[model samples]
Target: MNLWRRLSGRSRALALTSAGVLVAGGLVTLPVTAAQAATQCSVDYVTNDWPGGFTANLTIKNLGDPLSSWTLGFTFPNSGQKVVNGWSAIWSQSGQNVTAKNESYNGSLASGASTSIGFNGSWTSSNPKPTQFTLNGTVCNGGTPPTTAPPTTAPPTTAPPTTAPPTTAPPTSPPPGQKVDNPYAGAKGYVNPEWKAKAEGEPGGSRVSNNPTAVWLDRIAAINGTPNSSSNGSMGLRDHLDAALAQGAGYIQIVIYNLPGRDCAALASNGELGPNDLNRYKAEYIDPIAAIQGDAKYRNLRIINIIEIDSLPNLVTNTSGQAGGTAMCDTVKANGAYVNGVGYALAKLGALGNVYNYVDAAHHGWIGWDTNLVPTIQIIKQAATASGSTVRNVHGFIVNTANYSALTEPYIKITDQVNGQTVRQSKWIDWNQYVDELTFAQAFRQQAISNGFDSGIGMLIDTSRNGWGGTARPTGPGATTSVDTYVNGGRIDRRIHAGNWCNQSGAGLGERPRANPATGIDAYVWVKPPGESDGSSKEIPNNEGKGFDRMCDPTYTGNGRNGNSMSGALPNAPISGAWFSAQFQELMRNAYPPLS
Candidate 1:
């Protein structure tokens, strides 16, 4: 994982006002008082839609008189379109009509002021944009009210739909050499020649050597290629891009990992910059990479950038006053470097039309709990909005990077019950909502949209090391004796605990990278190149800025994260990012869909 870690170094809306408008035999007055009438308003309705659902973001500008509050109104062209969940406003739908009332924090709409709000919605027959809108009771965009008023009955208050809508084909891919909805679709993934060579050197490695793996630009040196570096060899950013073009590859995946005070929660992957070195991160690391990526020579290639891994999540789970909190995480959080650095990277790289930025979201074991999930989403939102980056700059998100979370737990589910108890009550689940990477990624995407991300955002799951295959893989559900017995027996992930993230024994290569494998998943990516060490099993000195994390040691017991259990890491592993032949051999042997 260190090679992957440092490859170089390795690593809502609207206001409404209304003038008095008469329609449908009723006044249908504006929500504002007579003194304040929003005579002019504009509703910027934008949506990212798939087959049966979509995410709609609406920006309402009060172009007329100021108002104390506003109520934005619209009608779904297709009656089937419905708001499932929303944020930054009080969203309610009645028949074909939708209304969003400003929340307490954004109720004030001075003339010319604007606010944004959005929702995750579902559509059955067809999804079409609402052509007309109303602020308060006044028609927006200078249009007159419809002859028929929308249903006035209050919408029934209910929880968001828990089940996903029916899967429909995603919209058509964009034209060639342009940004497509799924970069992996109809694209040849850039296979890192260096990694391919290493795999070819291994016993029976040629079988999967050609599969694509990400090129890690883990440090400043990694940008130009780290000569004499232990793992990466001398291939830098341009070298890889040139190779991809030579290979006629359609897309290349690059991990933009170095952040000021990176990986604050763990010692194993600590980065080169200090907590306050954000300016240096911008000028030195990000600016140079952005310059190279913006090169017209690579314009035809879809460059996927996996933004900083393990940074933002620490702000939620590992900051002081939280469970599993760390002093390093607290410092990083207080300095506001991680959020700002990620935002800056996103803005800089994302400005290039060819670059698709996927920010790293930690695995389910770390932030799947209710206590951790929402806050993590909020922090990510904060970062996405910081440093001049908007949600549009973010192409999507990636999960399970450089980790071993199973892609899917077929035998065990959160709803499974044994005897009289549910799986959530089991030791393995620990009341977490998700049991696998796919569920967490999909759920997180929807939650992100509800929190105001672009609705079209897709999710990528790194399946490099999650395949818990071979004979150890569970064949079916466990016996019905007890919850723990059921979950533990049938689980595919053979780690001592979900918190065991270092180089673990029995881990294997997961599904081969593929595009649109699941509903909302853009691709199954090998972001964390397999065979790379997660961290040293013992303290072996190195200048990579990495440290000895006890969790990587097979003999070390766990921390609060793993419930104080034994570390499940394999013995005698090398330091983070260095290649390990034993780990590669194990991965091939245990590959879920077993290597051919």
Candidate 2:
């Protein structure tokens, strides 16, 4: 996703007469009729040149009626302009000329609509200013016509400085290969039906591969993948579960991070449960979750409810208040969702039979950044354990390292606590590692050994949207950095090994679990579901085309497609839907492995 700026070297000359003359190598004239004069637009220029010359950016705002298209003209400042290149649009300039023309690839801009064009240029000196500027025969920035005074040209004696030609950027890193970091590498396709039946027949059934079986697992879980939320009110939930059950999913993790009234850290509306009205949050979310887990086909899919702790203010309020004890007390009096005591409420959640409550041991928790340390983990664990409900499989909680080094730091402390302390599963779920996946399998295996955990330890990936952008780990528990760690650095990290399908648009098979006994990672689970909108788009371009859209769209890249909709067109254009299903199957193959 690197944006490259290309520049072309050329100069523009304008001659004022009854007919406007634009001279590049050949003479092109525009008749100065009312139509041409009225259609004129203005260009405002800003240049970003550092130790090197600047890249001129022109904001072309049309002053005339909406036209099918536009052709702009601008003279480089100090004759120091070049048409390197542009994108999302195109640019062309006469040889050695800075004057350029642009055309929209898709459609025309409406009246008053603006478009931006930029070109790379090398200035003779630092921070050079333009001697003159114009757009479409009209002087830019309301400047007087160039005809009134001839443009000042560069001195004839000044010779051009010779510099090394620019080099092309390093090619993008290839999509991760199989055996990337796990033994379960590159297995694609859905669960085998025979295995699924055997798994279902087993008492309590299990998604864990047993007896060299391939049929007992869903392709989605194997790939650490998700299905697109259809237009159905259930949004393909029924079909999704069917697909999942086909894979012999004995345990499934569902997240209700966006329900209304989720007052984690006492942040108001931080929970996206969609309003506390009538406690409908529970009815709408909790009930459905219970049904999924309780279903006979998926009864084996133990339900682990992964909940986001707080919204912005809830996180901020809790952190700030806790940081300032008295301040927190006062804030709580006014707006504490846990006014009744978080410890008690957490205990109640632990008591829920069908729901294995998992809390985030992150930023606002004991091992959070700028908040508390592992002490908070100790506190929450104490409270949840003390709740005294022997809810079966009240399994362990997971930490959201968000893949950033800072967030990942706490795993060491938890690991230390678990290894050092006489902790019980009922008390704190035995620090069995709830943090997200790593960028490579080696790191994952290393942590497993170093942390004294085995393959049974719960290692979940919060690939809420796609896998960690190949290898770029998040900077904090929630901050994303775009530096592709895989490309910039050699080898993938544990997060990638854990199956964080963070990037769905990039071409490749979905991530498969590596079968390295050295890295004792247990289940590679998808903490993030597909089809769930990531809530960023348009105003947030990078955030757009995420979720199922990225993986399902075929035009984006890759040779395969997901599947076609009723319209007979690809569901999400550019990215392939076929790729998604294929990758999903690949992940399932890795996670559920054909037990031979």
Candidate 3:
């Protein structure tokens, strides 16, 4: 079977947040592929260790038909093995035998998709690898896959003599606190049905236009509402979390984006909060928000707090193209609101055991520029320090949050833009360099470790719209001269301009929320809800606290900054956080695995 068949059916396998237009919850699923023949997936495992403690990274491929749920089991040869913690699954071990089952947020699998799971373990004397593995009770092929392309010689694993009864235990509902002790076994994700109902109810929306009716329909939802004064200082955030718990959701993913001078480099997304209002940010913003998150009623629900988008990245690399050399972000940073505000929020929110905090590590485009990564490291460290806490208070950091950087840019080539150089084959990255989110994230994670962060700090990438699959992908690595085309089409992402942070065109839902796509990556989350507008492109008067940049103006596509006469603007989309009917249709249509 060929893995690239992008079409459903025996594809080799792997298997595998945010608001509205800002409760679109994180519990997301995608349109399913019709059942295909049973596929025997392959497993790739790696480990990094120090002393007795070690982290195991497993990439579980789905070779069979689409799986709604899955379970993985392996037995260590040595009795000294112990699973200390795990993420993305309900991990449990008995002696040397270990089992990891899918958690609520990540159960579905497309034919070609893969999901990841990881655990930390401690071993005495020697740590031996487990040779036998089974997924969903079916032992993995543990050999090279079969291919239609005739092999010149016999492919590996042609003769299989060994067999074992598949483990009978099926994927089960996670107990109220399955991994409370397992630092990595994480909280269950709660998708807000209210947002799902809203999306489905919208006029001319996805439910009416998308194909296949229903397969993985539950994954799409948005929480675009901001916490302006009318909302009682984040009462919206509180109420949504409450509703999630009411619906039996064990984990709630929340975005705290209303920062002062938000999105400073962009025309759109300027926040309602002022740059100088540190007092209000703390007293009215973080304090009350912390109260609700800290409340005993919500303690049962794991709160994944995504603190402030477009806040820190600006301090280092401001994408806004204000006519002046200085962007408003400079002002925001000067005021110290973005840094201090995030620090205070981290201190308050991280104090909760159930609340896992992820500060923003802007997408590669914004922060991956030359020296900006250093500043990102500095700023994150500053946030942790300002909070009067160590970096350990932060569960991890997130990348591409509310941004449209592709998960991987397979065709990015180094160019001296000032010298007018275009694409070249000098760089052929399989996604472990500066070109894509994956590499940037890996580098950032390593940099964090070097800078005194705990080894366990993980990452989350906002993949809501970075998929850009199928025909949308450019045909050649060095195909086009237009920089955007070169970077977007030839490369992985489809954004017209990296700085154009508004609702980007041709973007689609990326990898579903699975644990540990990469070593440091916790999960690929839809941090920005699909179907919501980045912000209004029309020159509409804004009473709401959101920013109104011409960048949103489909007609105003200047250089992607300052909403100038740049030529690559998307069509006029709806206001930020508003239900964007047409865009919603497009996202579902162009969905990576082909959403319904």
Candidate 4:
């Protein structure tokens, strides 16, 4: 079947924390395609040793739907494997001959697919050999008799597969209590100061620059504190991660909050993991983060792992009941290891090692959802801390306040109240609204750092509706600005992922949006892209065409559905005039030379 048709029955995937707009307590169930036939699949994992005196393990699973949840586990072999560095999944080992275990997944896999998992372990001797393997229950190579006969005479093969794809070197998992720099570092881009003025010139534009503050940039280099590069897209080499990195950005007070995914809320409506999404995160989100960290490109990139807490633990059911079932408080105890198993998987793959985790502080209005914000944070924090990370290494947690509407007076007032009373630093980024991207960004940075943080705060936007490139119309009433003015400002801190890159895609590279040249914003990020369509195909049916309406079609309005349809489609549509991508690009390129 074709991609869309194949995905027809699939539900949209949810992030660990993607939630309803500003609601904290209620579960987030993102919209998705009607259910398709469930694919059939199974997995088997094995543990082995390497010549480097370390323990190793492997997982082989039939891709009944190209599953991405394959992870191998191994005992420490006497704690021999110290787990100095790793990735692909969270892991841990005990004993002198350290053994490792398989990690978990949160995305997708198609049918009739198979993937393997392996890790390096260290031993006191020149080389140590592992002697165990487990697949859910059945055993594979290490010595245990296979439950079933193999095609070959050998009961189990101890040797590495000759066709084994080159192992992706894992990143160093920081010792329990150290704070590593964020992944986005030295993101080479020019920050224009005259962005706001230029925005007004766009169709149905407002004086965005004149309002509060705006930040912009074009061609932001994805710096991971390592040598790895950003994932490529239809627009050539564009950095999706730069938006997240922009959050805790500044020369002296550098801090980083590694929040993955483009349209997490849109992704999470499904409330359960799909094979395709599970694999996507492994290959796209989590793995890429690990690779960058492993490469050590931006050593200064402080690592702060964020788990979006949109849906309840039990949104999806499994043999044990619904996955993540039970409240955060109850589940952690019952499934702490499994939860830790999840964390461990994340940790083993470079999650818990040095990176401290922060969960969604609140969903709607800082505690609006069914899941209690403060209480859930307490549970997740306790569970995460139980992993044995250091207090200093663990940074305080936070969440997006309001419905990406921090620019509104209500969000500002509430945030002002929280910061005034609490000594603890709390950060909430505004979804670039109003004309105050800089204002909120600067405030968040100060609060985060003052609370003993090493860096400032972040300001992320929801630009999928606008399609990042200058071609789309302004969905909101705020004015636009140049790239320069937006990036550098008195109160501005950093810019996290503003648009939904790849996911909830907008215009392609040729038609991508550009920041106003005069503003000189920090980075003109491709928050949205071509390949990954928005969760709800309602907006633009084929994921093609031009104009902001086509790019941000959450409401299927492009097909003529109006009113509430437009509610999800565009907040400020029926734009004054048609979108002119060429004009926008010309203005932006002149200011941001990399684009020029």
Candidate 5:
């Protein structure tokens, strides 16, 4: 996920060659002949060098015709430089000249397509540029955009290894001979059989195909983890826990959703418990889960506890909006349940050594504004204090849970509706001004540390289906009163209303969840597994007993992503946990980074 940039010592940075800009080292450009120049294909070779090691990124552009196969040739200018490890290409070095052939899966280049290969190498005297790139025997010509054709397009790479890495899932339930130090490794998570069953048979169709919306392979079939919800049934949490323990799971991901004033301001997730039922939440809800998790029998298994989602953030929004006006949060504020509940969950659960508690921080769309962030952290701090639990009881914050906020910054940004200038670009960094979840997570880490939490506290992002890239994603801020229209790329998120908070269309799987994707980001997780609906679309409900939210109504389309609209749910979706086959297939087909 880290972009390629230069290192300090004798580094060469590439500038836009259009202005005839020269960098620290000699300019590296590709020359093409007149006939071949029609296409004007280009290649970008970049490197990040350190003292002894360096990284090379090789990008191939198809400005001309799509090719079934292509090979690239480049030579090292430094004599002592040698190749170490590489991905997406087969590399061979003879003297200072090196040749890289495309791998079986990626040789084909689509028109205007570009695929990249990365390698780690060792350098002695200096890391010089690999000048004069040639693709398929034709010399590539480099041009800095805005080119007639875009230079980069990332499609799904290849099928993920069906077998999870040995560190995560082993064949049977007993603890492995060596326990994985980091319980969440290689991004494997539990799957709900019910969702798979819905997709594996009758109405359920292909897990991988190009069938438009008919029945394509969704990543939900591959990378999602089940969240045990209290609304599903009394036994849901216990059953999910039992299954996880039975699998010899190194880590079990649990979502504690039954806050007394659950989803405080939202309708879809309104729990059976009311604002005044703090006792019920602590005694009946928190006590039982804590007892089960803290029990010594399952001491070795790590419990990844995602504390109340949409709970604390609502308090901020509610409290801030009701400033000295009619108090909308009277009941919640009276019982002190929201903050107290999270604290109780943490104190009780943190008493156990294995449970890593991630209290929800909401998504950037909700808390990115400075007005909302201050109170959210204050509530978290008060809650941690009220439980008589120190910051140690909390692990960091989690973002974009069951929400469709953009994962990376820059995918969406806010421009000034008043001024023509971009107001909040992704490049800007502040606690409350982040444009996306990645920056918010990083900012949250700094806040948590400042608020007495450990420096090592890390964040988890629910990438379950936030990968809104490829064709299904929107593209601009063009012709809209909205400030972030350009960042979101025109058409806004397809959710019916901004606050509808139910099943949403046009959402896809985000970056494959991985540990340490960036600093302060603990792991990218599928907290809200795809295929399972966010909430039921219609009142024509099932046995799950979750109340109907009009946001799920397919025809209830509205505009914008904030408080302006209240009914933006997608149509044809099933209840919260039930499989919505169409969404499943759609997610697989439209996955960001493309599902392999």
Candidate 6:
């Protein structure tokens, strides 16, 4: 039972009109007229623009009476500008007019409270700001009515000189590793030169070669370079950190893998340590890594450690008595190795002031259901509190790591229905509450906070191989014949089943790594380092302790987790963690947003 499947600010001040009384210093005087007192609000719109596209982040503040729900309406200055997609709200458009309605969870608005919403849009010719906005059918900017004619195109005050706008001002490096809200914010991501060289070696690879990727410390030997080791090459942990300093990078991402009995549900990633190697894992593995990271020399670097992929989720989905439980998972769970290992790792690595530890939360496909969701969070909480580590020791959680779940399914949603049947009833969705990773991650963050994690905690989604773009991507909703037809036809995740997790064919490079791409999301990361194979396509022996899992074999029939479907893995791939040229080429070829 490998649940393997599993997984801008701008301020514009509108002139106050006769409808509302104004005081000096941009404050509104109390006791306004009845009309003005009804629905006073303000909207702050900010945009991060690229050549032909941009992401708009808007913060709407309720300045008047509290409301149970709200609708935000605005218009684009040019007809060429269109809302491609949005999140945190139900977005709709008609010609130049656009509207966003609050989602169920975010509908309540206490007076003076604010909520954030945004969209990614495209533009031609010129992009201009909307001068007027309305909330709940009432004018928002001090009750100014919607203008009948298009406003003049004064150059957007927020637009950047180049296509890609700067996201944050040069951060004053936090005083020698003092913790910050987001390590990636305003910081340059360290690019692995070895990966860059490999990517650049491929034709058309230069397009994405420079993007930042994570460095995996999969084995203890990897902490210090071992001769001829393919994973880290000659670059050990210190070497990579030294190289990052040479490149003047502000931050570096390192995957803290290699717990005893790792990937108990899957064989491809089995670790060198046996099920009872807890003492060795701590003394030989974690202690050394923590010592290195805590060194004063590396304190200025924001070291992000992605702690253990495919570990904890096993306790929920693949443990004893579960539907698809595995013997190995049962043994590991019963012995408490997985929990103790993760907790020990978190406790040790988290003690470093400069290090940001993000425990791995398997993707939505693995634990998105009601039964699996809360238990998975509880296990994470248990681990966070174990071994003297508090919830504060864990800075955040990462989802979709080294897996291919689509970041968002733009064409279809969980709320959609076809022929009177909800999309969740379709074979593709299978009644999962979440239709994609973005929704699940946002929901999971809120759930984690409710479960006693810090409210300030954020989430990271690995966008490494989930683009699901290219000619196969659906342009719109599918035919309304049946729920299955609608979901299958329109869904962007092209896996044979939601449970399939391997070197998937037709996968593509997803959104490029960037900071604070959405609300509650810290960044869209390339944590998996795109070209590495998930596992060998066939039985290949190795000293690294990686066994051949059938899920990585193209010919192998499905397991209970994948509903007995074809593995959907590519052929002739190398062993796990090795570079697969064919897979890399295919990923680049089918990239969504099409690798421009």
Which order, best to worst by TM-score? 1, 6, 3, 5, 4, 2
Error of 2 at 38 (Å): 88
Per-residue error (Å), model 1, residue 524: 0.3
lDDT of each: 0.80, 0.33, 0.59, 0.29, 0.59, 0.81
**Residue-level lDDT for 410 in candidate 3:** 57
Per-residue accuracy of model 3 over 476-556 as CA lDDT, tens digit each: 654355554445446656554455567777776677665656766777776666766777777556556555666677776
lDDT (tens digit, per residue) of candidate 1 on 301-408? 989999999889999988778668898888888888998988888766665556789999999998999888888989998998888676777889999999999999
In the order shown, what is each candidate's alpha-carbon RMSD? Answer: 17.6, 27.9, 20.7, 19.1, 25.5, 22.2
Tens digits of lDDT, candidate 5, 1-596: 11112242222323324322223255543332343344346765555455666556556677777889887777788898988645456778889877888766567888888775655577899877865666777555544233244334655689888985677642322321122224465534554444344546533233422111111111111112324432222235546556656765556677777777666554555666767888767655665566455433455566777888777766666653442211435567667888787787776665444567778888776777778776788888888767545575676678888887667644344434324545453222222376567777788778767867666677888886777666756554444444444433443344432344566667776777567778767788777766667776677544333567566666554333333454545577666666677787777666786765
TM per prediction: 0.71, 0.33, 0.60, 0.35, 0.59, 0.71
- Candidate 6 local lDDT, 493-594, one digit each (tens): 999998989899999999999999999999999999888899999988788888999999999998788888999999998888888899999999989879
Identify the superior model by lDDT, candidate 4 or candidate 5. 5
Q: lDDT at 185 for candidate 5?
A: 58
Candidate 2 global CA lDDT score: 0.33
Q: After superposition, how far is residue 206 of candidate 2 from its true place, in Å?
A: 26
Model 4 scores a C-alpha lDDT of: 0.29
Query: Largest lDDT belongs to which candidate?
Result: 6
**Winner by TM-score between candidate 5 and candidate 1:** 1
